[model samples]
Target: MANSTTLSTGKTFAWGGGKSPFSVSYGKLMMWIFLLSDAFTFSSLLIAYGFIRYSYQAPIANTIIKPLQHVGENFVEEMKKAGLFVQDHWPAPELVFNHFPFIHGMHLPLFFVSLMTFILIFSSVTMVLAVEAGHRMKKDEVANYMLLTIIGGAAFLGCQAWEWATFIHEGARLDYNPFGPRSFAALFFIVTGFHGFHVFSGVVLNVIIYLNVLAGTYEDRGHYEMVEKVGLYWHFVDLVWVFVFTFFYLI
Candidate 1:
C-alpha cells in the first residue's frame, strides 16, 4: 500500500514507489548525473589551469601587431623578442592563437576560435530544434535538424584539428611549449582534447540517432525519447565548450 496525504485544498497526494519526484525519466535522470560528474571534471581542470596561469606573471601587452597586420615567418621569435612569450609570463591567448586558415602571416586574434565557438553554439540550436520536432512527431523535421547538427559538429571538429595542427607546427607539444610555459601547451591539449573527444562522441551519438530517425525507429517506438536523450548529451557537450573557451581563450 502506498502512503497518501491530504493537502490544504483537500486533494489527496499519493506517494508511489517508482515515481520520480523531479518529473524526469530514469534515463534523463541518469544523463543528468553523468553530466554533473563530467562538469566537475572540467571544472577541476579549469581551476587548476587558472591557478597555474595566475601564478606566473601577467601576459605582456602587444602593441606592435594590429588585427590583419602582416607578420613574417619569424612571428614566434618576434614575440619572444618583444617579451610577450617568456617562461615566467603567461602567453597572451591572442598572440598564441592568431593564425587563421588561408589567411596566414596576418594577426587576427581569437578569430578562428570565435568562429569555432559559433559553430558549436549553432549546432546546439539545431539540436534543440530537432528535439522540438521530435515532440511534435515530425520525423522529417527532426531528421533535417539532426543532419544540420551533425554537420555543425563536424565543422567545429575540423576547425579544432586545424588549430591543433597549427599549434604543433609552431612548436607546441605536450612536453615543449614555445608559447610561455610547458604546462600551457599540456593543459591546452588535455582540456581541449578532452572536450573535443566529448564533442566527437556527441557527434557519433547524433549520427546514430539520426540514422534511427531515418529508419523510423522512433516512430515505431511510439515516442522520440531517444532523440531527447541524445539531445541532452549534445547540449551538455556544447555547454562544456563554452566553459573551455572562456577558461583557455578568454581568461
Candidate 2:
C-alpha cells in the first residue's frame, strides 16, 4: 500500500516507496534532463542551418576557380583530364571532405570522417558493454571497456582538430570561404566545434571514472552506479554526433 499522510487542510498525499520518486536515482534523472535540454539546443542549430541554406539559394555571380588544394590533387587532375575546371559553386559536402590526413592530395571522399564516425559508434558499443559488466559486477571487464571508450572519444577529438586545421588551411573562415556562402563557413565551425568540445569533456570524465573503478571505489560502495551515470553521458555524446554527421555531411 502507498504511504499516505493527512495534512491540516484535510488533504491526503500518498508517497511512493523508494529513494527516488520514480525508481531512478537522482544522478540518472538529472542526466536525462540535461540530455533533453542539449537536444533542443542542437535542434535549433540544425533548424537554422536548414532555413539559411534554403533561403540563400540564389547563385552569386562572383565565381572564382576553386583552389587547387581545396579539392585535392586527384580531384583537380580528374577534372583536367576530362578537359574541365573546378568552378566555384555551392560547396558539395562530398568534395569538401574529400581529403584524408597524411594522405593529402588524394581524392577519398568522406573516408576519414567515416572512420571517425565508426570510432564514436564503436565507443558507444563499448560503453554499453561497460554498463553491462558493471551490472554483472565484473570489474575487469568494466575497466577494459571503459578504457576503450576513453580511447575512442580521445581519437575522435584528435580527428576533429586535424579536420578543423585542414578546413582553415583551405581558406574557410567565419566571414570568408572559398565555398559559395559565408554563412556556411560560420555554421560549420560553430556547430562542429561545439560538438567537438563536448566529446573532449566526455573523454576527461571517462578517464576520471575509469581511475576510480580501478581503485575499487565502487566495489567498496557496493554498486557501480558511477559507471552507469558516465555511460549515459557517453551515449548522449555519441547520439549527438549521429545527428551532426547526418545534417552536416550526408545532407
Candidate 3:
C-alpha cells in the first residue's frame, strides 16, 4: 500500500520505485505474446471455416437447419428402443427450419447467436470501462465494472448453453444434419460451441483476477496494470466473437 502511493507520485521515483525485468515484467510481456498467438489461432479457424463453406457450397444443393422428418407422436419411444430417432421420412431443408412467426418460411436460430453477440459486446464495453477506471486508480470503480463484466460473461455462457441444448436435443434434429457438408448444422454447432469454451475460460480467469484485485494484491504490489493486461484478453475474446458472428451467423 505504501509502495503504491510512492509509485503513483508523478511516475518519477527516488527510493520507493518499482523495478522489474525488461523495464516492466516478463510475465506481462509473455501474456501479451500469448494473446497475440491466440489471435492468430482464432483467425485461422474462422478463415478455414469460410473457405470450407464456400468451396463446398457449390456441390451442396441445400444447406439449412431443417426439422426432423418421419413419425409424429411416440416417435422417440419407438426410435430409442431401436437406438435411433425415427428417420423414415425426412422433410426437405426448406420445410424444416423455414417456420417463422406468422411468416411461412425457413429461418435459422441465428437470432440467438446475434443476441449472444450483443451480450459479449456489452461485456467488452464494460471491460474497457473497467480498464479506464484502473488507469485512474479508482479501485472501487474498476471493481464494479469488472463485476459487471463477469456477470455479463456468465449470462453469455448461460445463453450459449441454452442454444447448444436447442441444437443437440433430439427433438430439434434435422434428418440431413447428422451427415457431412450437406449439414451446416454440425459446423455451426462445433464452431460456436468452441467459442463458448473460450468465453467460459475467460470468465474464470477474470474472476480470479477480481478476487486478487479485491485482496489488495494489486495495490500492495504497487500497480493495477495487471487489470489492464487482463482487460486486453477480455477485449480479445469479444473481438474473436465478431468474426464468429459474421462467419457462423451472418454468412
Candidate 4:
C-alpha cells in the first residue's frame, strides 16, 4: 500500500494537486466530501428529533389520546368539531397532510405529497437519462432530459411551497404549534424546511447546467461532466426526501 503522502499526491503530475485517490475528478470528490459531511448533519438532526420526540412522548404515555375519527363530506370541519387538530394527541401524518389543491373540504390524505414524491423520483430518473445522454454525446437528448428534470424539480418545489402554506395556515411555527408538542412543528420546519432549501438550490443548479448544455459548453470541452456533477446533487436531494417522507410522514 502507498503511504499517505504518496496517495495524497498521486503517482504522476497529471494526477497530483488535489486529485482523488479513488480516480474521481477533484470537483466530484469535493462533492462527495461535502455530501458526507452533510449526511452527518442530517443524521444528527434526525437523531435529535427522535430523542426529543421520545422524551416528549414519555410523560403522556398513559394519557395518549386516540386520533379523532372522521368521515363524510366535511372531514376537516369534522376534525375541527372534535377538537382533533394537532393537539393533545400525536398528530397522524395522514390526518395532517389530508389536503388537496383548490378543492376545499376534501380528505385527500397523502395524495399530494405522494404525487410530489413521485415527481421527485421521476426527476432522478431523468437525471440519470441526462447523464447517459452526456456519455453518448447526444447533446439534444441531454438537453431534453435535463429540461424535464428541471421541470420536475420546479414542480416539486412549488408543491413544497403549497405544503408549507397549508402547514402554516393550519397552525405551525417555530415556537407555536397545534401539534401535541412544540418540537413537532419546530423540527418539521427546521428539518423539512432546510431540505426544501436544498431542493430550491438544486433547481438553480440544474437551470445553470441546462443553459450550459444549450450553449454547447460541454461540446467544446468534449465532456458533460458538469451535468453528471449536478446530477449527483439532484439525486442527493431526491434521496433525502425519501428519508424525510419516512421520518416526517410515514414513521
Each candidate structure's TM-score, on Cα atoms with residue i matched to residue i, is 0.94, 0.83, 0.67, 0.83
RMSD of each: 2.4, 5.3, 9.1, 5.1
TM-score of 1: 0.94
Q: After superposition, how far is residue 241 of candidate 1 from its true place, in Å?
A: 0.9
What are the per-residue Cα lDDT tens digits for candidate 4 across 200-243?
99999999999999999999999999998999889998988998
Model 2 agreement with the true structure over 38-94: per-residue lDDT tens digits:
999989998888777666643333233343334434453454344332233345676
What's the candidate order when arranged by decreasing lDDT?
1, 4, 2, 3
The lDDT leader among the candidates is 1
- Predictions in order: lDDT: 0.92, 0.80, 0.66, 0.80
Best by TM-score: 1
Clashing pairs in 3: 67-96, 98-105, 98-106
Backbone clashes per model, in order?
0, 0, 3, 1
Residue 222 local lDDT, model 4: 99
Cα RMSD for predicted model 1? 2.4
Q: Which ten residues in a row have the lowest lDDT in candidate 3?
A: 91-100
